[model samples]
Target: MLKEFKKHCDSTSLSAVCTQLTELSNQAFCVNNGNIPKWQSALDDVQNTQPGKLSFKPPYIAIDTKADVSGLTRSLKKLMPWRKGPYQIGALQLNSEWRGDMKWDRVKNHLRPLNGKTVLDVGCGNGYFTYLMSLAGAKIALGVEPFLLFNYQFQAIRSLIKEPIKAFVLPLKLEQLPAQPLFDTVFSMGVLYHQKDHKLHLQQLMDVMKNDAELVLETLIIDQQHGDQIIPEDRYARMRNVWRLPSTNTLQSWLEAAGFKHIKLVDVTKTTPEEQRATHWIGDNTQSIKDFLDPENNNLTIEGLPAPKRAIFICQK
Candidate 1:
């Protein structure tokens, strides 16, 4: 995958950042993620299946490959707790933790045309949406995910595609990316609230985007009545890394402070069980949206904080 990214950078306008990217990718891959051997084995197992064609089937990022469904399921389950997609490979339907299509439906229509554009997807898990971005006609869709397991998952899917599209997920984070204004469209979805300094995250996002490039920023938010923002004391919904949950107005102000122009708060939808549910793919602890929330009160999390509701803001660099 790192080599593929090197080839991509060498052939595209992104060559300026190639050296830094190569070094960062090498460092990322070498870090001991603990599950490397297990993940590598899973990738190897999937490769035994014949390569197939790819397509975007609205609710699914599907592969038209023929293989034993039992074998496919057995191999894929090794990478448990699939957090981001509902993919299909032949008769096997991998229903992941989240209904990613729901998120896509909310923001897809509002996005700028992807045709021939260079795009970036920050924290892209398994490159599911990255594949969609390429399918939508992006000249190239680069996804940066620091998690090595997800990077392997991306490779697992890519391996099964006869002629995969221009989607590539690298084992790197947004901060590791070279600060160059090259991407025409940037998507930082489900990632911002994890930052200790949300403002810095926004600035880093701005720095990498070309002038007038569109940014689709999506993350958790509190309502206006909550008085601007809530820096969670512990965890918002069972996960620990969450740092800030801002109001839509507060987010818009942050974007303005970061020098983004024409910010539009496009959509605000409360996450529900239907959108994020427990599935077999999620191993041992199959807890999901409902399990994380107070059983008596759906409006609040088990932590007694306001439940998860996300907002999407579209702006220009």
Candidate 2:
């Protein structure tokens, strides 16, 4: 994957940072993760199957090709807890925990055209949206995911495709990328709340984008009645890494403070079970959004905080 990424980078604006990006990705891949062997084995199994063409099949990143459904399912299950997609391969349906298409529908039409654009997807789990960006005709869609498992999952999906798409997922974080104003469109979906310092996160996003580049920011948010923000004392919606939930107004202000222009809060939707639910594809821990909410009140999390309501803000750097 890095080889392909390097080749693609060499012919584009990313040429200047290709070597550094590949080296960092190599270091990340080399990190001792006990699950690597199992993940690699699963990836190898999928690669042996009949390759297919990838396309959007409504709620799925569909791959059209025949394969031993039972064997394919078993191999994919080895890389369990698929979180970001509900992909369809051949006759098999990998119904992941999150129906990512719902979120995609909310933001897709509002963004700038991606045709021939250099795009970046931060915190992209298994490159679900990255594939969408490439399918939308991006010159190259680079997805940076720090989680090693997701990278392996991405490779598993990529291996099954008959033809290579202009999308690639690397095992690196936003901070690891070179501070080059390169990407024309940058997406930071479901990532902002995880940062310890939201301002720094916004700043880092701004640093990597070209002037006038579009940024599609999506993260958990509170209603204006909840005040400017809420710093959770503990877990929010059963997610420990969530640092804070800001109001839409506050989020817009943060974008402005970071020097963004033409900021617009495009969509604000409260999460529902239909969008995030327990599915067999998620493996042993089938708990999902419904499990995280208070049994008596859907509007509150089990921890007595505001329920999961995400806001998508479109702006320019």
- For all predictions, the C-alpha RMSD in Å is 1.1, 0.7
Q: Each candidate's lDDT (Cα)? A: 0.90, 0.94
* CA lDDT for candidate 1: 0.90
lDDT of 1 by residue, 1-317 (tens): 66777777776768888778878888888886789888889899999998888998968888898889999888888888788898999888999999999999999999999998999999999988899899999988999998887888898888888884688888888998878898999999999998998889999999899999999999999999988999889888998999989999999999999999989998999999999999998899888999999999999999998999999999999
Predicted candidate 2 versus true structure: per-residue lDDT over 1-317, tens digit per residue: 89999999887789999999999999999999999999999999999999999999989999998989999999999999899898999999999999899999999999999999999999999999999999999999999999999999999999889997899999999999988898999999999999999999999999999999999999999999999999999899999999999999999999999999999999999999999999998888889999999999999999999999999999998
The lDDT of model 2 is 0.94
Give candidate 1 misplaced runs (Cα > 4 Å): none
Q: TM-score of every model?
A: 0.97, 0.99
Clashing pairs in 2: none
lDDT of 2 at 109: 95
